[model samples]
Target: MSSTSSDIAITGANGFVGKNLRNFLHKKKINVLGISRKNFRKHASEVKITSTNLLEPKLQTKLKNYDALVHLIGTGRRSPKSMFEEINLNLTKNVIKACKNAGIKKIIFISGLGVSRSNKSDYFISKYKAEQEIINSGLDYTIFRASYIIGKTDYLTKTLSKQMKKGVIIIPG
Candidate 1:
């Protein structure tokens, strides 16, 4: 790949951090291919996106042209549509397989702040499992355990604001 080519693929590109990262990369003149489950057309028109589930069989083909993949598809809050093991662990496992198949050696994963084997929380355990998968995948990977990224409509800020309205705030360890 040449220096001027679009070499990055960002998963969950419709999310807050993903959008910010896309904008930041755009500013730096590094074009990226956005991958998300939903069709989010409200972002910069120059950025191209592929709307599909990460676990889809065609993921490797979609990723084949990219040099690296930024796996930002994990979820903290589990719902009927999204679960910890499925989104965090299974998706990550698929990503590793896709990366290997696509010949993309580099993977950048965004994990939660307190993810570890010792942490028995479902969320942390899922993240930990994802991290372990990446580590054992034999790929060049970078995992960032992000804490609270407070910005416009960020989850942490919104949660804190809701808690403040209730009169009592609980800070977990």
Candidate 2:
């Protein structure tokens, strides 16, 4: 891909970091293909990604012709139906497969900080597994293990703001 062809496919484009990244990339005149479970009715972007779920096998066909894929899809909030391994690790496997099928050799992944050998948390393990899959996938990749990203309406910030409204700001001794 040429330097001038900055067409990027961003999954989880509706997320806070994804939204901010899209805006930043757009300012640099990079064309972005926003892919998310949710619809962006008022979005500035024009490309419509038909596939919403990565698990679907047909997703690969729709993902073709992009310079690179920025995979931001993750679920920090887990439920009985959605386990860490299933959501994080499994989804990553599917993404890698889709990337290969679409002929996209490059991928940028958003992982988490503290995904270390010592950590035993399910979250860290899942992230580590996801990273390992990407490494073993034979794709040229950039992985970002971010601990936290603060935006005006970031998930953490918004959650804290809601707690503050309920007057639960705690000061641990």
Candidate 3:
């Protein structure tokens, strides 16, 4: 792809981090295409936004022309094991496959920290597995693992703040 051609695709663009990233990328004059469940068209008039579930088979063809993909789709809330696997693991696999098929060169994945093979939590385990899958896919991939991101409406911060206010401290093992 030519340096002048600016085409970037971002998944989970409706989420907090994704929205912030999109804004940041836009400020740098990058042409961003967002894929999300909610419409971001009004907020980003110039940016092309598509609302679709990543699991759908149509996503492959839809993502064909993009030069790179920023995959941020994941389930953070506690849920069933299958739900985590489906969103974090299976979705990543599909995204990798789509990128490979579409000849996309680079992929930037937003992942969580503390994801390891030895981890007991399903969430972290699934993240580790997804990272492995991305590595094995042979695409140029970059993983950004964040721990307890601080945002205005961050769930972790809110929960911790509430607990602190209650004067009852409970630490996760």
Candidate 4:
């Protein structure tokens, strides 16, 4: 099926990066469909939200009509190692498989910078594993390994700003 009219499907559309993307795409007059856990009431006119658990069995059937997918689902902070595997590894695998099954031609996956298989952190390991899945999927893909994105209300920036306000900052060795 041709994906001429279908909108771009953005996962994690309620997130900081997703919000920025949504605004930019809206300004460009591009249609955006958001797959988010919560309702997007503010941008409801320009974006449509679909509440979905990424691991659900019905996900492929639900996402069959989309033109392309922008996968932004991931965890940044430390958590149980299994959480990383679930969200970063398994969830990504499911999405890629679903897109392939649905005949979706393109995927733009948001990944973290400085991730490697040799890294000690479980976070980086999970990201690397996820990227591997995408690479081996045999689908048209763009993997954006991004650094810290600057936004006015970004959590990282806010935390950094707060720390800088204090006298001396200690760097981890």
Candidate 5:
């Protein structure tokens, strides 16, 4: 990092990883702006958080002049209202558009581990497509295929806790 901090914007800033990253960056004296679908709880005054629906066209305007965008918005589960394509693939497209429009030259995306063209799983397919979209966008990008990121309040911990309450846990051999 240079003596002057670069402005960095993080999407999904309310998530476990996002929150940790924001705090880490802040400690390093970097300027971090959080973009989330929900309002963030009260925190340090130096960090700014904004709420926005990524699917809408307003994201580009909101992203204006950021040096880089950390796109952490993604999902492995499916709901009746939202699917893998909608969140993983579509939202990535939206992010790319926003980044380009805002003149951001770099994107840091957290994709899923084992997401490849050969994987037939819907989650993998969607993630694969999202990675492709970023690669094709011609913007500088760093994508991490993270497997299980465990933390005190991480998704894996919550899911395992629920399974434990069920009295039976399923693990592949």
Candidate 6:
């Protein structure tokens, strides 16, 4: 924040997509400031969180000077405390609020593929809600509904491997 504006600010920059995107952006000489939920501390102007909850409203003061935000804070899998809507939608709400507070426009979000208003699946519904929040927030935004990404120990791939061992490939219709 002391220097000029950053090219982009990434939420969930510690995750798989965020890591790859940051690397690609860096190669293009784009300066990135990252926000993470995991324990992250500025690593050469990248790592930027420790017990970081993007939901906190007070931190909006420090979220300034970023040209755009890449919102990657979401989950496909779920637990009791980490339900899809609870984490995904809520975090997105937080991001929108922070963006509004910081006067930051243009957020880029990667949402789940095949998610729609009529989607019956809980995961898709969660993503749809998050998307709707961004749309209604009156901020410039882009939502990318991405299909399954494959890589070493990635989320989808890991889940597929685990379920395969259980002798069931639960493909959602």
Off by over 4 Å in 2: 1-3, 42-45, 50-52, 55-58, 78-82, 170-173
lDDT agreement with native, every candidate: 0.81, 0.80, 0.80, 0.80, 0.82, 0.79
- Give lDDT tens digits, candidate 2, residues 10-78: 887888888888888878777777777787632475365545567565566667767789999887774
CA deviation > 4 Å runs, candidate 1? 4-6, 42-47, 55-59, 78-82, 162-173
Ordered list by TM-score, greatest first: 2, 5, 4, 1, 3, 6
Instruction: Itemize residue pairs with steric clashes in candidate 1.
Output: none
For residues 1-173, could you state the per-residue lDDT of candidate 6 as single tens digits?
A: 43544578888888888888787777776777777767644446454654366646545655676778999988886554348878778888988988887888889999999999998878888899999999999999999999986788588888899999999999975
**Model 5 pairs whose backbones collide:** none
Best by TM-score: 2
Runs of candidate 3 exceeding 4 Å displacement: 41-46, 55-62, 158-173
- Most lDDT-accurate candidate: 5
Better TM-score candidate (3, 6) = 3
Better of 3 and 5 by lDDT: 5
Window of ten residues with lowest summed lDDT in model 2: 41-50
- For model 3, how does the per-residue alpha-carbon lDDT over 1-173 read when each residue is reduced to its tens digit? 33886578888888777878788877877777678878764345345556555545566665666799999899978799999999999989888877887788899998898888899999998899999999888899999998867777666777888999999877966
Per-residue lDDT of model 4, residues 1-173, tens digit only: 23445467788888888888888777766677677777774464454555656645555565666778999888877699999999888989988977888777888998889888898889889999999999889988999999988889888888778888985565666
What tens digits encode model 1's per-residue C-alpha lDDT throughout 17-84? 88888888778767577887887763453445565555556666667778898998978875533488
TM-scores vs. true structure, each candidate: 0.83, 0.87, 0.82, 0.84, 0.85, 0.80
Flag the better candidate by lDDT, 1 or 2.
1
